[model samples]
Target: MKNTKAMRHSGPSAELEAKGLHRLAGERVLLDNISLSVHGGDRIAIVGPTGSGKSLLLRSLAMLDPIDAGEVQWRGESVHGRDIPRFRSQVIYLQQRPALVEGTVEENLRQPYFLRAHRDKHFDRERVSRLLSSLGRGDSFLSQHQRDLSGGESQLTALLRAVQLDPAILLLDEPTAALDSDSTAMVERLVIDWLSEMPSDRATVWVTHDDEQSRRISNAMLQIHDGKLSKDVHERIR
Candidate 1:
């Protein structure tokens, strides 16, 4: 399967779009000709039961999993192996379980600054402090050890840090799956608020099993079943 026109736009648009996404692991098919057109500011939720290929589809879009068939187009150009890393920086991926390094939250948050793209840029401590606070964490979390933090705390910090990277698109896989209700709500609020505040051109593809979560944050919904996309659902409410 191939998508001739990978992106569709009504007006101005962002370059992020998934085209002809198909993958297979051995004999098991993970995705079948999945194509999604994402304009700027589109909040998409991918929802399905376990083993429905929601996460696999996200991995394929992120280019972390090799596609047995199909390709991803960014800015109307097909992205190959060489462009993946750079594309990833613009299109970030956040796993359900965020792996924190062995250090303070501050150090972990600052890790991305060491990358060449952010090397010369000054670290904004104030921004980090505010983000942490918004996620129900305090400034003291900066001094806390990553290993000592609870699952909610760690995930909150990870999400704040990822958003600060200012990616054009964020691919989140069950972002709040491990959190308590309060923490989950906080994270969800953060995502919604951020998307609402940011330029209307940013896009987010969130993979989650939580129906309420999906309903709250998604403008469009995609359901996956048996390794295939089962039509796009327009109305948010069932």
Candidate 2:
């Protein structure tokens, strides 16, 4: 069955929109007139060749980098100043390499709460454990030291850190690119579970070069080339 909310004709207003987003590096156009609209419950996969501005587009949407022109809107409104921090909290951008501190996995997951943006939110160990278990991890996973974890473990920890906060939007940039096949499937399962938890309230924008992975994870596929986005590539599942 199709998610009627994500259909082209009807749904809630866009949760995130990039209007004519442009990023230039001197004479080169990194992101050219990039426009995108992400509704709630959207699982969008962006694919492109290397150095084709895939990462740039994601970072631009995350508001991590300044756009030469265009605006990023959250909930139909432009974000600025204090709103940026709040926006970032709700719209997390996870990179391929997650930075872990010298501590246990649980501690790293709990660290976000210490930030002013997430002060009101407390870490839910139970929820985190459940997420870990979904990926075949046990309670011992959380107690393990960060340095002792493998590449997949580190990425899982990073994903948990973001997902635990209940972000409305997730911007994943090749999150499982470095892991083995088993780990990749684990990461994929975790994301699938996360989406199912709040089918109508959450969304993810994943960047990956793997065509097979893109089809498996996204209801819609977006192709980016030469700093432009093409919507005609893959029709939304109906």
Candidate 3:
């Protein structure tokens, strides 16, 4: 019996919020008036079986996929058209599958800095190396070809790319699904360490099919079933 609603919340302002979000697929509802608030220091785990709309919920929150209805707000401000790019920078989204382009990982990492929205930020190799070293990899990892990397390496590269941006909210959709036990544990540790660095101003929403992983990753739990959301999960954390 895990307690989903037993979260300890940070007072006042929230970092991100979804209000009455809804989505449709043909005639069926994929997301039904879903809403949740992610405040600074909040770590929430979203759990559900396959085809239960868990990914849809995370994508909606990330604004990668447009919701048919509802609004996504950051720091209480509604995110609109022109602000999408900037919003994305602040709230990064990482999919389960690695979507790296063909090239050295360093190239993939430098891609974001070239984007118009991120032009103000510069790519720092030393910082990148530091992050890689933290994951037990040396600076040589950056020189590895994206196509030549292993499953775990690719996932690690993807995470490194996102962490460099220092997003305030991270929307993780089964990032470790394709990874083995050791790799999965590495990913978890990397992310948790990153969050611990800014515990007061950063939060993450992790979606995992593994109950044990969810319990370890989140301070609170949310279950989505048949397109609906359960704020307080009553199942015991094993």
List per-candidate RMSD values in Å. 2.8, 3.3, 2.9
User: Regarding lDDT, does 1 or 2 come out ahead?
Assistant: 2
Clashes of each: 0, 0, 6
lDDT (CA) for every model shown? Answer: 0.78, 0.86, 0.87
Per-prediction TM-score = 0.90, 0.94, 0.94
Query: Number of clashing pairs, model 1?
Result: 0
C-alpha positional error of residue 214 in candidate 2 after TM-score superposition, expressed in Å: 0.3
- Screening candidate 1 with a backbone cut-off below 3 angstroms (N, C-alpha, C), the clashing residue pairs are none
lDDT per residue (tens digit) for residues 88-191 in model 1: 87788899998888899888888988886656565689987776676666788899999898898888778877887877788999989888998898878777
**Ranking of all candidate structures by their lDDT, best first:** 3, 2, 1
Per-residue lDDT of candidate 3, residues 1-238 (tens digit)? 1222354558586678788889999999999888788888888889998999999999999998988999999988999999999999999999999899889999999999988978999899998887778778898889889989999999988998898898998999999998999999889988998998999789899999998899898877888998888656623342
The order by descending TM-score is: 2, 3, 1
Per-residue lDDT of candidate 2, residues 44-78 (tens digit): 88999998898998998899999899899998899
- Model 1: ten consecutive residues of lowest lDDT: 1-10
Clashing pairs in 3: 1-235, 1-236, 2-235, 2-236, 2-237, 4-233
Model 3 scores a TM of 0.94
